[model samples]
Target: MTLFRGPVQAAPAEPCNTFAVPTVIAPIEGPERVVWEPDGPLVPWQVAGADDLWVEIDHTRDLLRRFEAEGPQPDRIIDRIENAGHLVVVSGPRQSGKTTLLHKAVHSLALRLDDRMRTWSNVEQLVPAQERWTARSPQELSHVRVVALAGPRNAPAHVAWAAGRPLDVDQVHDRILRKVRETLGKPEVEDGHPPGSEDLYVAYERLSRQLIEDRTVLLILLPDFGWGGEGLTGRFYRSCRDNARCGIVFFVESRNDTGCADDLRTAFGDELGTENVTHLALGPMAEGDWRDFIDARHRAAIPGAAIRVAAEVTDGAPALLTGASVGKLRKVLYAATQHAHENRRDEVDAATLRAVGRAFEVPGPDQFRRDGASRQQTEEPRP
Candidate 1:
């Protein structure tokens, strides 16, 4: 089957003059020197440099190191998972490091299980249509597994598609179980597991058995599980709870409203309690992290071109922060520094930050206010 690939657009070439703010004086004592250059064919100054901002990109390695060094929190997730139960639900605000935390967990697990365990992301690639068919041969199935099902928040098309499906609750459950069985290469049921025989749970047990027999582990990554109805949520939570041998079910979600977490708690009740789940929240990176990032970038620089670029972008969202290029960031940094040099200020101040942010069209207080209002209006239910 042909899959749709989204169209690619060339990055804008012209520096965004509107977004460029007046450069501020160097915050630290340093010789007056040019920090950036504009020679590349690619847009030279698009993103902010590390030193020019209050926040930096969320680096998984740094986070893991910090967590390990500082010791776990009172409500630490890794500790909770190790001591308590198998199911974990990680929720956080949009652009929070929920997905990154999930990936980190998978990485840690991979160290112990190695090739025996496999990690799959819900958003990685579309499941092949042929997965709907029953596997007729043993070669088709896998062993122990971990699966993550992620969907984007507010995916109306996804919601509509699921709602339009004709399958009842039981049918939906059965189909999911069958798919699991096929993926694991287990013997197909001549007469399927009982109508409500906890088939979802049973399928997990079968997967575990395959893993133990093959001496391998399976890790499934399910992200975006928050984008469905309560019933679907309930079933998923229930399946995780009842299946004793299932490796782990990691539920990744944006921390929008506490409603999503509350719903999961209400739906699963005793079977899938909060105590059994792990909650990981990804927040903004600190200035220190940004400093380290800058140091690294500086090391990578071509001698004299090492300049600090710091501009607020997308509310310091990790995706957006990391999505931009070094050159773009360098341009903003250079522009800001030049402005500061011209102004003869001792240090870069908040005004310079704001100017740089505005010049880049990074959403400011005004844009944020407008966006917040729009979000409220859209979420409000009609009478």
Candidate 2:
């Protein structure tokens, strides 16, 4: 027994590296693999590692969908029109997605038309052409035609023409008619009619018939119509009143000034009594819609990363919800997560929210301080 137990060698201590307990280490030379635990407080290095977090978040699609759904409810508009002809004016604050909504409505209309036409036509060939037509000519009619006088620069020119300013309406009308003829692959008709004349209306009617024999639906997207003056609004209303067969005219205006609305009402006051001129005021996005948008953006940025904080920071403004970069957004979110983790919160808290907001370098009112408010009165709010 003494011989057998002569040397009870101590077992060699297992290497420290092979220990089962977790080891937190700083970055060292050579290939170092690091795994982070969600339970621990976020280290500054961890926050720094998420530098490109904002790159993952994109709320553009969500914002677009919301604007499309809320603004141009075509089915509702069509239903309303069943009883009486209605002029639905879609107005909103500048850059509030009015033009985008208009385009979405046009897209939906094209899709509906395509679905109905698929029953008869070669669906493949028709589909591509339909898509092209949606962009090229939103309003395709046999009897009437629409000329979209839009584009930031051109709209002002059209407004000037309508106001009987230095610009000539007849020339502008001829140019637009030529553009339409070219678009439809029809031979350009002579500029035979004078502006603001009965013949001008006749020529438009004839042009509409040449393109399509049925009644034509014409939609003129006159954005910032107020820029030209009160006279421009009056001229547009009169044109719509006179040209029933030429389809309806849609006037898009900014909602910043009640003056625009007043001008429009005054322009169409008489017509409003006998004809259907309706005003639609588009308000800001609903709180729920904004939250969903923020959540979507957060998921997009981080994939599986929890977005408990970014949503709180955006506060649901569509511009802010969709506009910030993913990396920046992620930094804010990571900071928020870290704050929450340290505070032993299962979810983000108000302090965490404020921290996230601060991380974004959001300026206070004083930082945005401006002088000469009276000087800014001359410039119209940007659309």
Candidate 3:
């Protein structure tokens, strides 16, 4: 029943971690701030889509649960990821909850990693072969390493091989190695350091395999990988896919082409084989779907701020809510909740929503102003 067998290193003199360990991985050229840091628990509607107060919609809950439950289960989907890595394609229109869902999934996976690391710590000689794993603090969640596979718009500054020239596999390999080192808090060395093989791909393959040898999952986030008849992009995808032992999740905007997922599947299926790729698409939210989300926020997160929707508020009640997109809906509701709190209103009725709409300059129907609700719902704050 020995799950892990590695060389044991002496424990540190003190329990506290002395050196900087990579507890998080941010895109080298993405958002200026870290991805998973939450300041405090605020009203669910007050935060942006990517914020910690994300509402679990019907489509995303199941996938998120799977990530949370990711462990050493041999029969699960994660086992497939461990074998040859896996690709998850998430497609949605603009403002359709893509970023929110992906962020939630990554957060869930990190939590699972934290739990597994706790269990691993209880066993002797079960630590990773790498010395960096021995240097982490108990408070740090370092089991899961996240990195962006491709930057947004595939910018040249972020991706080294993304210039107008032909695809250089060595350049791609070197870029990935640098990011991985940066994630592990290791000092970056010059090209071909400790030169194993002249082939850079071989070097990258060995490092990736060793990094995940302790059952750690390297989660690669790729945003908006537009398919353009399999030119340099396809080569880049193939090069990365073939070399690394990492799980990749592609977030694509499907407003332009609804078949973006199918395109990716057909393109990578031959290389990855069948059942290794799963695609999830987020579309418009139904009335019941969004209503449940809002109600759940009220019941669980924001019980004090009761915002009852009027009966007249049908699927298209808030005319300013453009496209029923979750992102847009969240923004509008956040503004409404802010206004309600500022104005000292107990309930966010149609009138409050109308005021929010006017302030945001979101044109609404004339009838919406007349359909204000007279009743109110309230909840006392917990002592």
Candidate 4:
């Protein structure tokens, strides 16, 4: 008999079926206000404004932590942020774990926030800021700022903290909103702006300029940015993307094939201008990604060879990998590993992979692999 180690987590029982894509939520007509502890059951999509946005961000952060994901491995975006000089555009298909990746990246950035006087809050615990922070100099800490935008589809968030300090999510988000409102000459005290006036890109550019002046660093994470069309925020972001000196690193997630009208391609044009804006198309996991995904967590310590075969059969689709009902890949792998162990093997073998794949009704390696980039620059706009 074998025992599991410290980090080996059980696969989640539920499927990754809830869509984060906020539908065509028409911009609210009047000045949007932030109301905390609202009455009645409210659909997240219907509410809009700063507090609501705050609510959305808070909800988004929580929803992710609620799941038991196999630990994510370090990727190009994480590497680039640490090294600097890159704004990443993360695009992927519907239900492809793009939001999850964004959350992981923010968590990484939070680890870099660098404040000993503050505490980092996770879903279930309070972490010391010093343990999570990573900055060698006060100057480094001052310049590097990270903010996550829940965007138009969700409510704008208004997390407040003490003055001139950013050691917590509330502080970082509040500071971000305040600075933008200040730059726009709006009252800094207001939690939200008038509808269509909460132009995030405008706020982003303003913060970028201030950082540039102080030689500081900024990382802005905008997950599910469902705003496009000739909106105020849209053009603001476009103009900033054209500039070479915008000194901010952006991690944005959008529909893999967002409309041309959205101008993401235009903003991140041609190898990201100076690689200042790095556009990465995320699709199915590569065979190796699958291997790493499974291997990262202590999921029965299945042999690498067997895991690779399992990954191949799924064709790297995150939906299939995560969805409890999609391919049952997690359960299949677990059973196969147990079978191999019972056979007195050290690793999963080809026979086990086949037997499991067949029994679990999962596809084989011959299934068509849909790379995310296949639709790049070719997906026609929806009518």
Candidate 5:
């Protein structure tokens, strides 16, 4: 008799990660539009709903354990984090779905951080590949926190512009401390702060640094963060740079803005440099993507009907496509399909598409520009 441990078969080659790579983002004639070149082999069904942007979003929401979201960008965002390491700075234009992207990534990282393996099946699937089988291992939990969700409508105009006020280091300290306690399930160590030390910021920096040195978690998500105000809140970010302890993700409209940029330079410093920073540029999807998306949604191809109308009206912007009432979209889809079926047409034409757009109240170019100009005029300062 012989005992031989043969190599277990390799897990099926994970589908080539074509979706994670970057592609050409071509500028459109107007509408601040940029196109995503559909060069990747990835298809809509692989990520989520085939053509229904709404369906893809709902699928991601369920996966991320999030309830309030219009759509999903987990593919883009997850890749961004993987490439950027722990500290990421994300910027895109307003209404570009930055919030959705961030939340999706956070949800994914939280699952990994809180537990190395979600299920025995996942571990069984992975361990053989790594060949690092262990018995009775201690599962470490990282404290992952979602710090802020400030967006345009709800945010205070001056959140980041506090002029020479004390940095709210105490609040940051307390927040981190609370999460740390939660992580440890109790206070595990002492002797971080000095006796009678009135400097809360100093105490916080010391404590946070210690956690980093000991290897804790590295993720904080802040939407439209106003951490640039001269105070402890800003220092908290810089301290992460100084220590390289955690990942702080900032989702903002653009890097052209001064407050967030100024804070990045101040906290991360020239020493940390761009080496530690990742700027993820998000834009509109390609026409081909929408074609695939639509085909997937209907699960059948209509010869003449494509997404030209929807793409033109929404610029293929996920924010515009998503975040709408599903009932409205369902109605649009039903009408288009019903019309095509009734007419015995092979495809959905521009007229049917336009009807869908009209039903959704998606403005045309001239109308959108007129509304924009009117708003700009109204916002103009009076002399």
Candidate 6:
């Protein structure tokens, strides 16, 4: 994880994923208001002003832990996209940090592809000396272009793309075409050419061939992807697949609750059967990990608070973490921090969390345990 600022105090370099308090937060004047505002699909390090409350602690272990317990690591998914040149379906319960993992992968890829990082005279000052731009595979691509789009969950058919709404099919096509034109320049249309006669395919074919020849990778990320019948989504996927010759990879994100996984399986059964397409389902992590994450987030939010959050506060709040998505966890933490700020508390306590949980309808510890036990008894294992 790249830290946002210079270290005020040097701490012992603990092994990756350990809760060693990697970066010291400088004290802030007056009152601090911290919120986890997501700046699109870009990682915090890549986004300007998004690292105000950022900490250097690596949450990769948390992700890896979840993967080890629930599905294959994200590296395998990336490998399928990059090495095999296949589409990967990444499914998880909503708020399972699917975008977070993908953003991390893209950030690392950007770092590796940036030759300027190696050529800079003050490279150590710009990038941390400890940071490694290690190549993941032997066949390293020199260039990359990432186009991120999310699937419309409950969008109206009339809407194209709006501030909060996902992009529809037409908008998706327009965005892809715009990217192609920006990269490869506009193609001239013949004077007597008919409308929609192989122009789109020709453009994509040119894109595919140029990327292949230039050793550039085009990664298209489609998160929150749901199945809209053949006319809607089927044509979208089939069209891209038909035109893409090489150097194009798609990362499709979907919620497992929806029949999106089955839809993808049916649509691309051949690729799946051939192991060219892979699906990774993300699940929640252990309670201890959640506790650590909460503590880390708290420290990052407040900087130099008097004390860390009480452990029992988290231990007793399984309702906030158990089977809860990372999104919910962040919300709970955000509310608790706000509560602390409003109450002028140095550290978030049980009272602050309790009040926050009440607003979010989180159950008490006993009720959470009972529910967990019930789930264990009734729930079937996932294939």
How well is each residue in 1-383 modelled by candidate 1, as lDDT tens digits? 12223542222233222123212123377522222233221111111121232123554455555433342222222221342224545544343444435544544443333322222211222223221111111111232244332221112122212554533445544554554556556665222556564665555556555554554444444444333343555555455544535343334343333345555666576644344454444443443443454445434323223224443322253322243233344455455655655675433344564565556633222221213342442232211
- The local lDDT score (0 to 100) that residue 129 gets in candidate 4 is 26
Query: lDDT per residue, candidate 4, 348-378, as tens digits?
Result: 5556665555565443332322443445332
Give the distance in Å from residue 286's predicted Cα in candidate 4 to where it truly belongs.
Answer: 2.5
Q: Rank the candidates by lDDT, best first.
A: 6, 3, 2, 1, 4, 5
Off by over 4 Å in 1: 1-85, 115-197, 226-231, 244-251, 254-257, 268-275, 284-383
Model 5 RMSD, rounded to 1 decimal: 14.8
Error of 4 at 36 (Å): 26
For all the candidates, what are their Cα RMSDs to the real structure?
Answer: 15.2, 19.7, 12.9, 15.6, 14.8, 10.1
Two-way lDDT contest, 4 vs 5, winner: 4
Give the per-residue lDDT digits (tens) of candidate 2, residues 135-163.
Answer: 22222212223344654112333443434
lDDT of each residue in 155-221, candidate 3, tens digit only: 1133432545432546655665677667656553234444333465456545555554555556665
lDDT of each: 0.39, 0.39, 0.45, 0.37, 0.36, 0.45
After superposing candidate 4 on the true structure, give the runs of residues whose Cα lies further than 4 Å from its correct spot.
Answer: 1-86, 103-142, 151-209, 212-215, 227-237, 243-246, 257-263, 266-273, 288-291, 299-383
Q: Lowest-scoring 10 consecutive residues by lDDT in candidate 3?
A: 374-383
Q: Which stretches in model 3 have alpha-carbon errors above 4 Å?
A: 1-52, 62-83, 113-140, 148-173, 187-200, 212-215, 225-233, 246-259, 269-275, 302-316, 321-323, 358-383
Q: TM-score per candidate, in order? A: 0.47, 0.48, 0.59, 0.39, 0.41, 0.59
Model 6 alpha-carbon drift over 4 Å, by segment: 1-45, 48-84, 108-142, 150-174, 183-201, 212-215, 225-235, 238-242, 256-258, 273-275, 295-307, 315-317, 363-383
Candidate 3: the clashing residue pairs are none
Q: Which pairs, if any, clash in model 6? A: none
Which residue runs does candidate 5 get wrong by more than 4 Å? 1-86, 103-173, 176-184, 187-216, 226-240, 243-263, 266-269, 284-289, 292-356, 359-383
Please state the error at residue 282 of candidate 2 in Å. Answer: 2.1
For residues 1-383, could you state the per-residue lDDT of candidate 5 as single tens digits? 11114462322232211112112222566322112222221112112111223324432334334322312222222232342223445443333334445444554454454343223113322222111111111222223333442321223233333353332544434444455455445475332343232544344344445444443444544434344333444465554333332223333323222244556666666654444444343433323343344535443222223322234433444432343223333345455545555665445565555544555654222321213342332121211
Clashes of each: 41, 11, 0, 10, 9, 0
Greater-TM-score candidate between 4 and 6: 6
